[model samples]
Every structure is written in C-alpha cells, then in structure tokens.
Target chain A: MTYWDQEKECMARDNLEKLQLRRLKETVFRSYAFVPAYRAKMDAAGIKPDDVNTLGDLQKLPFTTKQEMRDNYPFGLFAVPMSEVVRIHASSGTTGKPSVVGYTRKDVDTWADLMARALVSAGADKRSVIQVAYGYGLFTGGLGAHYGAERLGASVIPASGGNTQRQILLMQDFGSTHLACTPSYALFIAEVMHDMGIDPAGLKLKAGIFGAEPWSEQMRTEIENKLYIKAYDIYGLSEIMGPGVAIECPFRTGLHIAEDNFLVEIIDPVTEEVLPEGSLGELVITTLTKEAIPMIRYRTRDMTTLSNGECPCGRTHVRMQKVLGRSDDMLIVRGVNVFPSAIETVLLGIPGVEPHYMIILERQDNLDIMEVQVEVSEDIFSDEVRKLEDLHKRIAKELESNLLISVKVRLVEPKSIPRSEGKAVRVKDNRKI
Target chain B: MAKQISVFLENSSGRLAHVTRVLGDAGINIRALSIADTSDFGILRLIVNDPDHAYKILKDAGFTVSETEVIAVRMPDSPGGLADVLDQISEENINIEYLYAFLGFAGGDALVIFKVEDIKKAREVFEKKNINYVEAQDLYKL
Candidate 1:
C-alpha cells in the first residue's frame, strides 16, 4: 500500500521547492494558453508566466474572493474546456451564493491521492476499515474521504450521514476501524451509542477524521476521550478540490499543506497586504496543478497562519494552523464581532442547559437584540411560569457577563428544537442588511 | 354513556389546578381525566357527571372548550377483564390508539376511557356482547 513516489511524497525542503517550481510553471503556462479569463487577468496585471520564475513573484497575481467566485458562477473559471470536467461540488450557501468548483479526471485523481496521503499521515493503513459518515452528494466531504480510503487500500464503508441507529449497527457489525465525520456528529454518535448501551470501544474504531466545520481544541480532547480514538483534523474546501488540501499528522501540531500542488498565502483582508509567515491573516490559496478550474490566489476568508518549521513528523510540506474563524460568518453584535463558536463555548460551560440552543437576532428601535433560547432538562426545574422566568433571567445575566452583550434568554422544554444531521444552524439574523 | 368534555389550556403552570377548582366549586364530580400536552399548549380530556354544564361554565369563564364522544366501557375487575374488551375490539378490526382506566369499588366492575379509531364499531362490539355501559347519571353518582 506504499505510494509509488514515496520518496517524492516525503521530499526534503530543496527537492520540494524544485518540485513546486516545476508544477507552478506548468500550471501558469497551461492557464495562460487555455483559460481566456485567466489570461486576461494576467495581462491586466502586466504579469506573464515567464515572470513568475520564483515563489516570490506570486504576489504579482490578483486575489480571488468567495464573492468573485460566486459572481462567476458554475464553470466560469474553468481553465480547461467544460467537456473535461468530471465532477462539480459546491459550498453550502448560508449567506449568499454558493461557491462552485469543477474538477477534471486528473484533478479528481490528485484529490484522492492527497486524501489517501492525509489518511496515511494520520496512521490509517490497509487494515483499516474506514466508516465515512459525512453527508454525501454536492458536498465533497463524503466522497473525498471515501476515495481516499479506497486509494489507501482500506476497507471503506460509505455509511453517509444520519440514520444514527443504522450507523451504530454498521459500526458494530462491520467492526469499523476508522470513523470520519464532523466533530459534533462524532460526539452525537458517541452519545447515541452510549444511550443504546453499546460500548464505543467495542466497535473497533481506532481513529477519526473530523472536519467540514471548525471545532475547538477542548472539543477535540472531549471527543477523543469519549470515542477512545485518535482524532485528526482534515481541512479542505470545495473551491479547492474538496477534503485533502491539508491534514494534521500524528504530531497534532498543525495541518501540513500539500504545497507542491497548492501555494498558500496569508493576507490582511482589509488591506490585501500579504502578511509574513507565522502572522495570523486570511488564508488565500492558488492551485498550481489543477486543470478544470485552476484558482489563482483564491481568498479563502478563513483566518489562519502558515509555518515552515520542520514538523516532528519527517514531512517537509508547510503547516497551517487550524482555522480560527470565517470572516464572513462573524456576527457584529452591537459593534463587537462575535463568532457562534464563542457562544457555544460559554453555553456548553453552563449547567442545566443542553448543548442544543438557538440565538435569534432581531432589530428593535434601531438597536439589535439577541435572544438565546436554551433547552432545559426536565429535572432542572418545576413547570411553573415564574420559576422559568427566574431561570431565564439567570441565564441572561450569565450570558451577558460572558459575551459582553445583553442577551434575552428563554427556557424551552427538551426536544423543543429541531435536530440537524449536517451543519447545525444556531444563529438567526433578522436585522436588515 | 358518561359525558366527555375537552378543555383547552395554555401550557403555563397552575392552569390545570384552576380548571379542577372550577368543577370542584360547582359540585360537579369528575369521573376520569386525561391530559395531552405539546409543551406550549395542553388539551385536558374529562369524563364528568354533566359535560354540557361543565363546558358552558368553562366557556362562560373565557376558556376554550369542546365536547366529544368517548367510549366508557364497563368490564369485570378480575383477570382478563380488560383483555376481553380489547380482544373483542381487535376481532372486529377496531384500532385503539390509547385508553385510560378506573376500577370500580364493587370488585367486579371497571370503567375504561378509550380513544379508538372507529367509535361506532367499538360501541357495536360492546352492545352485541351485552356489556353494561355507564350512563352520565351513573357517573354523577360516583
């Protein structure tokens, strides 16, 4: 199950640098010759493929944002003809239009190769029976992990998301060796397994690949303790060819980016000035080897930093810190940028309230107010309106102190809110744009 | 033939007690009661001595209420007593979603409040079996 290019896969800094330059040159020349839009952009920037002879010359290119990608819509930025596209995946459009990405057969193979490498880097091997529970279709998380497990010569059970009972049954029956899904879903699966009186350790899951949404290190430790498995973070975006753009090795230091195929950059989002390495800034990427839709300096809007220091693991690829937060997803509550993850941390720390809650934002009298509706356990309090109001006030005061914003709290009964199998929608913004 | 009245109440606290107090003050006795709640609201099912009067009293007090026909089957309070009634209903292909029960003091009779899919068919089964059913007046005495 070893890679044919094992030496190349673990290339040293000098060798990796040479490999990247060759790939970058090929990609730029291909794009300038084939893609009219890319050629026009390069022409307007007064830059040519021959001009980008060194890595330092990448800044001469223009940056691509999610809004720009969405504005172009489907197949608009394809470097190759539409006939060469083998697959297309899109992001979940919570705010506006979803960003669409197209891939050629070669691009798909490269994606699977990187994903397989990622899994192997995370200790997966041929003996592993990987159970993929990410949502399938349109979204890349499921298929991306699926192909990787297959490529790694592992026994892959593509048990897509939801059907918790059936998922548990398969995990037990098939003795799944690896679990892949969102961190929240992994915890949810563990909860269901406990409720069903099934020991998660007995199911034979040895490791997990959790991604698709950002999770905290506290949550990672909690999940690892509960599932009794080593959890690795796999990062990717559909716009960047799905899951396997980067992955965390066993060192758990940071995700190692496949810089040979993709060049990573950190830029100040407001000023568009590229930041020095190790500086936290918006993550921007450029696909050096992709053919169908070769993105040049695509602004991910995700905040993180790049590290060139050698990892404890012998790999020489650059490392990226876990995504802190999405700039677009940040909520400006009374002039303070608040992320939902921050609220989740404070909420989970509180007693008497379940993790399931909703933050409703409404504008009243030209001022924005947030209402947090938390589900209380049946034993928490008696069924008295006054007692419920008192509990609500307590929760409101606690939230106000933690979030630094006044929040109206409402105590709801258990199972009052709807459950989601994919990304959980916790915030509802009703203010006028 | 016991009378049944449906009481609508908001899911706030002490609402059930308030409704019970109104019936207790009027000197009207409650034979049996069942409550269904969806958290935000609740429907109180009552089998009373006089359902029409109870409904009017609650309605006059600005409470939303209604009256619906529910079977009041009288069975022997011994082994296989309720099973006999259910067996008869099942034999006639009547579906019983839920039911409530109260044992009579004579040690031989019991009253069952049943919410069935087909009320007419259930009543026919009881009538054909010659089962003694309680009337509204009998409930008032209890």
Candidate 2:
C-alpha cells in the first residue's frame, strides 16, 4: 500500500511535465555534447538542445533506429567514459552482434530506484522474499531485478535461470513471496511444480513480476491461477535500461511509465510522424537522466498506445498499453526475441541446408513454440536416416544455443516450401495476438 | 517385397480425405490402409497398387511421403492366427515394426501385412515354417 517515491509517482500533470522538460533538456544537451551519434543526428535535423524546450517540440529531433545502435556497436554511443561507467548490458538479437549499453554508478542507482518503485507499485515490500529467475550475465532481467529487490530491503534470492527443480525447492525453503522472470518461464515453473506434485497453495508466494517478453492477458490469468500469485507485467528494453521502465499498478489497466526518468512518445512508424494521444503506433523514448548512455528519441519499434487516465492507485504518469507487436518481423518465443533473419544467418552458415526456410510459431498450452522448417539438400536427404536425424538434432541444438529458446528443427524435402515471387515470407505466426 | 506408402499428416479435419482425394485423382487405388495417430500428428499407411507412382504424386501434392517394404502373409481367419505368426517372428528375433489385417477370399484366408526390421529374414522365417506368403505382384493384382 506504500509508494516508494510518492512525490514523483503522484505529482500533478503540470509539475510532472515540468520535471520531464527539465530532464529532457539536460539529457539532450548531454547527448548532443558527448555522443557523436546524437550530435550527428541533431546536426542533420538542424535541431539544438534548446529547441526541445517544451515537450511539444520533441518531434523536431531525428529518430534513432536499431540499425544505428548496431552501427555504433560496442562503445560508440556511450556519453560517459569507461572509467565512470560501472556496468554494461546489451540487447539480445539475431545479428550475432548486440546493441551494447553502459551505466554509470549514478545511472545504476537511478535504475535501482525505478525498479524499486516498480516493485512497490506491484505490492512488493521490504518483507517480501524475492526470487529472481531471469537469466544473468549480458541479459538485464536478472541483475535488474536483483538490485531492485535489494534496494527495496527484501531478501533477494539471485536464482538466475534454469534448474527449475532447484528453483521450486528454494521457493518453498526460502519462503519466497515474489517471483521475477518471464511469463513463459513462470508457466514452465508451474508445470514443473505440477510434475513434482507440489501445490501452489503450499508455497508462500504472494506476487510475481514477469517481463522480458510480450505476454497476453490470458497468460497472466493462467500464471495467476496456477501460481496462486498476482502476476504483474513489467516492460523495458536493454536500450532503455532494461526491465523497470514501466509496470502495472494494482489496478492492472495499463503500465505506468516512469515518466520522471524517461519520456515516452507514440509515433507513426512509417511516416516518422507523432500520432495523437491514445492512438497505437511505434514507441519512442528519450532518456532523461541517464548519463552513461543517454538515447534521444530512440525508436523502440514496439507498437503500443498511450493513456493519460488518472489511475485509482494515484500514479499521475501516462500509462502505455501492453505492446501488441513489433513493427518489424521480430518473434518472441519463450522470452527470446528471434528474428527470421537470425535464423537464416545461422542456417546459411551451416552446410547441407538450403537458404529456403520457414519459421512457424504456435501456441501450445499457453506457451510459445517456435519450429524452424528448413529444406535439406537432396544429397543430405539421400543420406542414412541416422545421419539425417543427427543433422536435425545438431541444427536444433545450435539454434537453441544461439537464440536461447528450444527450437524444433524439421528437415523437409528440397523445394517443398512454397516459394513466393517477391519478398519471401519467412514467418507464419499463428498466435491469436 | 511389398511396398507400403506412409504419409505424414497433421491431426486435423479433412487432412485424411485430402490425401485420399489426391491419390484418387492420380488414379491410384488403395487396396488396404490404416492410420496411426498421436495427439499432434498422424501417419497414414496404405497398401496401394503402385507405390512409386503414389509416392511421387503425393509428394508433388505437398504431402510428406515415404515407402517401406512389408511382407504379406496368409493366415487363417480365426483366433490365434495372428498370434501364431507373431510368435514365429518373435522367436526368430525379427522385430515387427507394425502389422495390419487385410481381406482375402472372403473367409477362406486373411492377408496380414507385416513391416519388420529385416524383410529378407521375415520371408526366410515364413518359408522355413511353410507359411503361405503372397508375392508383391500378385497382391497388387488383388
């Protein structure tokens, strides 16, 4: 029932926008002065930091794309020197090269504050025992949740990911009350609990914070029912400093962006024009206080609309609808973003596989399943069954390792997949989303 | 050395009929058939007159098809007839992958198709036991 930062969370709309304007000007000035990419973009657009005076003039800045992040690569976009930056994380993608981000010591503190605010908003408190199940290392979900739980004064269990059996055991033994991980993984944990004959009621779990993937409302209901916990959706991207950008309050209508730290805008993805309020379009964000890697109008490509409704929970920041889908052909399978081009790159790297391939996405038991169907060269098909099966397993294993999702690799006959005359259709998403 | 056509099918409505329709349009007559299904997919096995042609046509129609050699054995149309042949094959350590019954002479005798690990070994076992066996060409005519 308590708010982490009540003043900021429930500020008046005018006051909130004023604070945002101040931070926006400072962030733009820093990005333009320190980061060459932002400088070049502003130069091209003939815009200056003072030009972004009111939030209305934010449209004049050029948009930043994912390709620009890739073009900058490792440390090209950092606003601070490496010595001042304390930690780094990167977005997972199919390009083999990731979009790297850095966080200074103060930036890390700000991230923890926002995450704590998110947790407290979702009804987590100091007494709650948090179990972080997101993968650790380069991915931000694990460490992001860990720091927030620590800052909230909760007993943190840094149970990174995998080892579901042990995770269940710890959940019971540690008296874990909060779970932090992807929604699909939460379902998988529930399945493992059922397999182990453990009842959700027997555990002391009270709530769960699930993110790092786009999950449906039906999935949230399933997780809540199976895990006997109030499942809340958390949204973030590595480019925007990972999973605590926005989260659903207890009311659960939509996610409330941490507007004090990041500014949000909805723009027409194609025409590069900002859409009106409450209309669905691609999301763009400008980092307000991030000094390490401040991004100016970074295009998220995630499609969602904005809501300024006053929440019953009293948070006055704008709420964003849960992301519907990407403007591009990025498929999220079991919490991992899989690009058809990434699959194609891996497939083309291996021998005996044709360039032709199809990615089939299906939903089975409220979980996402991705199957890669690739054509096998005639010579490979003519080989013995054992050899062919080995190849199949090999491709599946390789893809699973690279994509971080279990993939079922099917080898079809050569030239069997229907070839299109223009723009090969590589993905067939059968999910009702 | 009888040939059995096996088609992979998704467990959905109209999929089986679609396969049969494709075969029917191609002038391929199915003599005997059975389907083995799981929750996700099914494998349709058929004893057709021309397996190579049927396989080609089914493949061309966008269905996954494969051919396997099966031996046809004539057994008494009564209890323990199948058990007798299975006992013999089991004694010889010849694994029977699958088997199905087919009509023959309307009650005089019944033809049982057996797909085994080793077709030659199965034929030799049937020959040693003096069990009646139908040749592939004669079975096709029937």
The candidate maximizing lDDT is 2
Backbone Cα, N, C clashes tallied per candidate:
0, 0
The lowest-lDDT stretch of 10 consecutive residues in candidate 1 chain A is: A378-387
lDDT, residue A76, model 2: 96
Candidate 2 regions exceeding 4 Å error are A330-433, B1-40, B43-142
Off by over 4 Å in 1: A1-9, A95-97, A349-354, A377-403, B1-142
Per-model DockQ: 0.02, 0.05
- Candidate 2 chain B — worst ten consecutive residues by lDDT sum? B98-107
What is the Cα-based lDDT of residue A168 in candidate 2? 98
lDDT (10s digit) by residue, model 1, range A1-433: 3332367557888888887778878878887888777788899989999998887788888777777677777667778777898988888876788888888999989988999998998788888999999988999999999999999899999999999999999988999988899888887787677667888768688899988887767667767877899999989998888889988988989998888788898998789999999998899998878988888888888888899998777777899988877777778889877777767666666554556678889998889898887766433443223444556677777788877998877655444556667777778899985
Candidate 2 chain A minimal-lDDT segment of 10 residues: A377-386
lDDT of 2 by residue, A189-274 (tens): 88668758899999999999998765566567667888999999999998989889999999999999999999999998779788
Distance from true position, residue A262, model 1, in Å?
1.5
Q: Show the colliding residue pairs in model 1.
A: none
